[model samples]
Target: MSLVLHLDTPAWRAHLAATCADVPGLVPVAKGNGYGFGLDRLAAEADLLELDTLAVGTTPEVAEVRNGGWSGDIVVLTPWSRHDPLAVDYLADEQVITTVSRLDDLKLVAERAPRARVIVELLTSMRRHGMGPGDLPGVRSLLSSPQDSGLRFEGWTIHLPMKAANALAEARELSSAAASTIEAPVWLSHLTLDDYRTLTRELNVATRLRMGTALWLGAPNTRRTTARVLDMHPVKRGERVGYWQHRVSQDGWVVVVSGGTAHGVALTAPSPGANLRQRAVTLATGAMDAAGRALSPYTIDGRKRGFIEPPHMQSSLVFLPGAATVAIGDDVPVELRLTTARVDEIREVDAEA
Candidate 1:
């Protein structure tokens, strides 16, 4: 019994090609569980795309990319510090580009690994790890004077917030500011095609787009998570079931399915916004929980099923009201946020078949 991610490889590849076609100079970002497909798999996919560079979120992920057989330049998006021993050791490689967001970090890189390649990250509206516009002059001065330490200035990178209505305006302003301080290409994230087109038209420097979610999961509902039913038992109306012994309001079948916390089943991501609508959604979800009607991802016979209790580490107990049509050994579809899911296996099926 297992939770499996079934991929339609042919269709996925088509989508990948189409996604890359629209965005030129693409730097595919493969990080954090590889967007539920694992890091190594994405790295190989990046190679298939024939991209020149790949961006990762951390230093630890560097080995994963290398193990995947990706020979292209690998850029670490996260800001680096001399305090980090692994980054200090690995940043010396010519093929590696580490982002520096602070003056101290810039100085450290110059002193420790003078020949190391670096991309200076500018602060954006996102307020993540990056240097402010004022920090660029000093960085330019350091890059201008070639030290034997060989600190190679690759380009500039900026992470943008998704909520801005006019992202191109912000990107244009930011790109102009970055270029004025130090002439280099601008690496960006979270920009629409329109935004990219507009920015590229106005900005003289080259623009490289870093994308992850839209690149891999371009087709909606293309992937599915299937869990095998392990056991089934009849239950009486108002009968107590599950580990916490939650009471069932109606007659149902208690199902033991092959998925739980370890598989990322039923785990909720943090809410995105604190706006009224988001607050209302949170309140409604809480209300459902209070009423013993919490929604479950497991779907059987084309309908969603409920949980008998909170999921376990490796399995889940789902409550199917009324007569049980499902049986042990049967597979049920589970709707999952792929980024958060962990399946035991991933089977890539031919789209044509």
Candidate 2:
């Protein structure tokens, strides 16, 4: 069986509603592989929640939200460049908010999208895009022009690295600079609970948090994935099963079940260890896990099972000592991490006796 994305719609949505409930305003980031749920799907859900707007990673994904019957503002995180002509048309007709980083990029938006909404992306530690503090004056001059060019300067944007200490403090500095530069709102990422409260008081302007992960896929450890155990058999030491022809180390059950590299099982990443070799070890481990969506915590007889060997392309072999208690066509829960199995298909089967 191939991969099937098992979606717990109500559960996921409820979690999202609760996490973002505290914030006065929210701008859900619904771009870039839709963070595994696909773009249109995320937009539809965002629309249902009646968020202020939906943030996308790139311009192409705008169509995804529009196609989903969303009429809210489409905020593109990518900096506006003269390279893309369509930016003008979208800005003119739709509620598109283009993020401008460089002065030239801002000029491009002004020239092409004279009547467009723009957000000045300030430079942060990530250094992806955004005008630095030094460039603030130039940006203000463009906006302060007498003609105004119908350029609606709504706010500024900045993306911070998650899990970084003093992330909020760092953001406050940028936010302050942006606010001092213009009277527009602030759009940001990589902020913590304290940062929100502190900035909320320090910066007196409309602010929108362009958040994902925490808002949509928080506590990834809790989510579960599963597949059916297709078949099973007994094998002894020195016996070979898989096409690789590797000998077994012990007399354990040679269980043939569903799942493989295609499902993103064995695919894992290295841990944050002290040495380069330690980091390399994690990367190598992730490569195999990704290859064979090996069952890390697959449910068997209402209990999870363990893997015998690395997973194959389309199926995984598990050492099932409880195979007798369990049976064929049983549901196996695979506890999946969204960071690893962010976007994947899962196959579920009817549980058997």
Candidate 3:
């Protein structure tokens, strides 16, 4: 009952639906530990979203999703490897689409998986995933050869990180170029409402945006998590507790509540009060070194407590003043970094009680 993440699935689903409403043909991405939901569950949620295609990070994951009966097109975002064609074919017969960033890897994949669908990824803002513009011409030449038959060029994909306007702008620019050269849909990422709306009026080609966070976790900031407080303790200024040399101070309550490093309850974002918002997380750890004090999300006797030390792997210590009545089995609400933590459970808000 303690240290569990009670996900508001309905609220999360509604949020995704609302976000994807303006963008037509949204392809929800489920990759990398399923962003903490453990890929399989995210696959189920994506299917529930009625998506025709899902973007995963690897060829191995394709079987995990396909074996579960997810027949949708498995689009592997990672570039193709000549070392593995049989693996790709098994994940997708005609529907599995693999991404290629290097020109040399293209022909190799074609030879490996004769019937594999392939997507040529162009380098966008996130240079980590695609091929540079100079390499595309040669790759195009390789694919157009009458002799090559195994791998078919399905579409183009652009993975633009977090830049809402830039992502759409780059998509439009790439679409104009791809239209003149090849007849294929262009896949995209990190787009906003206005970006898609802008693309609709300017670009003519089919564009599909892949979304993971927006689809599963909803707004990064709006979703709040909660847990139940399991226990509490009374201690003095020099009282000792916890593993290692951790001790209690302030001559107050030694609060042991539900949620910890394991529950996804600790905050990764810098304190909201920080002057610079994004770097606050790193800055906080630095502050802890200077002040010799550690803090975490702590709710006490119904009043939220402040962290007294760095969080333990399974539990954390919160400092509470006297007069607080928080007891064992009492529930506490917390804000967590959804990207981290185990995401032990996903539940509704009504069940938050």
Provide the lDDT at 269 for model 2: 57
TM-score of every candidate: 0.96, 0.81, 0.84
Q: Where is model 2 more than 4 Å wrong at Cα? A: 2-11, 83-89, 146-149, 219-223, 269-313, 321-325, 339-353
Error of 3 at 132 (Å): 1.6
lDDT of 2 by residue, 123-176 (tens): 888777878878999888889762775688878887887656688778888887
lDDT score of residue 326 within candidate 1: 91
Tell me, by lDDT, which candidate is best. Answer: 1
Error of 2 at 108 (Å): 1.9
**18-118: candidate 1 lDDT, tens digit per residue:** 88898988999988888889999999999999999999999999999889888999999888977778788877787889999998889888988888889
Worst 10 residues of 1 by lDDT: 141-150
Candidate order by TM-score, decreasing, is 1, 3, 2
Regions of candidate 1 where Cα sits further than 4 Å from its true position: 147-149, 274-276
| 95: Cα error in model 2, Å | 1.9
**lDDT of model 1 at position 94:** 77
Model 3 lDDT per residue over 45-110, tens place: 777777788888777888777755577888888787656765545534677777887777766666
Model 2: how far is 197 from its true place, Å?
2.0
Each candidate's lDDT (Cα)?
A: 0.86, 0.72, 0.69
lDDT of 1 at 148: 44
